[model samples]
Target: MQAFTNADMSDKGATKPGFAISAWPDTRDILARLYDLANKEPVLAIKREQMERYLGYFEHKCIKSKSMTSAAMELIPGGVQHNLAFNHPFPLAIKKAEAAYLWDVDGNRYIDFLQAGGPTVLGSNYAPVQEKVIELIRECGPVTGLFHEYELKLAEIINHYMPSVEVFRMLATGTEAVMGAIRAARTFTGKAKVIKMGGAYHGWSDQMVFGMRIPGIGALESHGIPAGCYEHTQECFPNDIEALAAMLKNNEAQGGTAAVILEPLGPESGTRPVIYEFNACVRKLCDEYGTLLIFDEVVTGFRMGLGGAQGFFGVKPDLTVFGKCVAGGYPAAGGVGGRRDVMQCFAAGLQGLKKRAMVGGTLSANPLSCAAGYFSIKAMAETDAPIKAGKAGDRLTAGLKEIIKRRDLPFVAFNHGSICHLETAAAMLMDINNPKIFTEVSERKHVMEEMGAAFTAEGIISLAGSRLYTSMADSDAVIDDALDRFDRVLGSVEKKK
Candidate 1:
């Protein structure tokens, strides 16, 4: 194997240091090339064949999982509760997970690259966080509906690690955190419009549903939601500062822009990476317009680092939303953090005394979750888990790229620290502004889903065949083993041809 290096990769420019927007201005061009490569006839045919073969293996080998999926379909929509659980052949009924591995009910062991959909950076079932959660549960019971010390501790730790977050408010889920962030932004700025990156997912919230995934198709998946819900919401192209500026200017004439929120690494956790200086540019824009800049870090928060992408990019947002690892992989893991003045919108008050954002949850900041989150952040810092996972990610990225290059395939693999994206579908390159985005995305959807099934069949689970989140558990040996599994899958292209 030729030792891999990202000598001419897209992430090199996407992850460049400092505030120069011109650095790596050709990122979109690099991405377009990858997309074109994946769409080639020979590559599509190979991927299609692998998808079929893998689906057959999944149906034949995973009898118990098939039966379970069938049973669950009676109650669960699409045979799974969460969208991530919906795999091509039937979702696997995982018996348990520890470190970087998962075991299905049928005794199948697989290397977990999904990482519970980008949360378990320290690895699934991380001992320290789990132990802390259990201890808290045994001691103080789960929820008190009152203040808890762990809440203060968690908030304080996050603020310490991410200085931009001067104050914080725990929430029940990423959806609620996002909703709260928007509410705070509106309350603070007294503006009615918000701008999000097209194709980025902030949550399934009614207002945020516009321009999801396929983009340009406002409220495409939101059948029940009325147009009024997203009327105040607008979308601009990812990495395109000019589009954002135009949207802001337009909104100002109607009603001033409240906030401009984004997944700082770009839509869908760097599936479409931004130019290195994009965040700083946005920061400058928001400052000029008096619009609160909110970074939806639910996926990027602790996964990127204690400070998340905001820390990595060195551009401070007025507000930040978090999820997943924020609560150490607990069931309810999310919160909002921001400057003291902006976060004051979430402060408790009497009904008529002060205007404030209405945000509260039955389980928000529960002792168990807070304890787990506090311990998780502490452990991540103590063990330098972010740096370790990032190194492992670099190794995995290099190795996967090597396989794709060696096989003469058009696939692309890149990573930003621990968060990795392997874009065989190259869906991000689709121009969301075009009316044809719907047809284009639909045409490419099958191969992408099949690619995910192929990875699962090869004992390598991924985030819908597109993304991988590496954790500290993914040491050199683990990454090597995973790369070996990936190579086997990629090598199947030769067999198919």
Candidate 2:
């Protein structure tokens, strides 16, 4: 039909500046661009190819993310849920993970850099922790519906490490503990308002998700969350105490602001690591207002030091929520810890320890999770695992810095401990006023992801975003292995022409 139309149009002597049919060439050009967009270099096409190439390797990965998605969709809205975990590629279905390795449904092995996004500080499936869980499973059953010995032991170890946790309560996720801490703060101080640093991710709950680096201004990413809930949850810029003070003072008419929540190191995402003064000012502000402060240490806890960011920064929050290394690499563990009076609201009986906060889940403190956690903490405490990881992270971070310096790549690497945090040379890649950093993130991001994929294709696996981690299992050999891959990937991305 197009040919016939072209013939008819041609027969008309290609009527110059005349009929509607004469504009056929321009229409064809537009259609050609659209077709290119579907299969070639336009935005959608480029993004799709990236996703396809990346995810297509999953069958060889031996993990079945599809099965996980199918099972989760029965109860979750988007197969498996969580916004950050979502990627251009469908998530890989994970079947088993052990000692820095993962097995997918397709039975392929991957060196894991996700490390549960920074929780597996000691490496996945440590032998002692696994043995402890198995022993508990065989002897005491999975969950008791009553108190277990491991719970108290675990808390005792935590208290030994962090003095801020005078009293604490356990839950299943960092999200749960964060929400609980907010409730405790409000209940203890009789205040309704809270403050959070922008770009930091505390949890997924509606109340805490506001103003958290949503890639756009004043727009919250979480759906079904009531604006009324965030009306009192003020968002402040990190490292700027004045902005926080202004918001607190400005919102003073909105009722009492009970708490300020921050990461105490960096805002966790979308920004670089911060300095100590940044935290000190916020602590000073909290002290001035008589408001309780909460540190959402889901990322920094234990990974930073024995006391996590509190020990590292020497600034403590009134309440702290911990996950990640607190459970080693096991399932169903997270908790809230802080001053006694605040935690008193959650007692089980008539006293503070026994008073019910009217929230309970059969699995909130389930025994299997507690068992794994108990050993995880105990094992980390006994061995030099934390220190080992920290030292390894230092080495890896140092090597990266050397690479960047030598290659003159626009990249920077920093680490608090076993975690690798990096940012692209994009601050140098585009003009200062590029309208949208995210708009170009697709093209520029491929350079890093392809680098990562190449790293995986080599012998080591790294976090999907170029983040790396060191584990207790990591040694001079492990470090060399990862660096070989790292050298290869880094060489490609920032290689001098």
lDDT of each: 0.80, 0.64
> TM-scores for all candidates?
0.92, 0.79
Query: How many residue pairs clash in each candidate at the backbone level?
Result: 0, 19
Best-matching candidate per TM-score: 1
State each model's C-alpha RMSD to the native.
5.5, 17.1
Q: Write model 1 residue lDDT over 311-426, tens digit each, in one string.
A: 77788999999999888888689999989998887888675766789898887888888888889989988887877777788888889889888887777777777778787666
Model 1, C-alpha of 336: deviation from truth (Å): 0.6
lDDT of 2: 0.64
Off by over 4 Å in 1: 1-29, 38-52, 433-440, 494-497
**Which residue pairs in candidate 1 collide?**
none
State the lDDT of candidate 2 residue by residue for 403-493, as single tens digits. Answer: 7677665465666567665544232123222355556656656654655555555545666555676677677666766666666556655
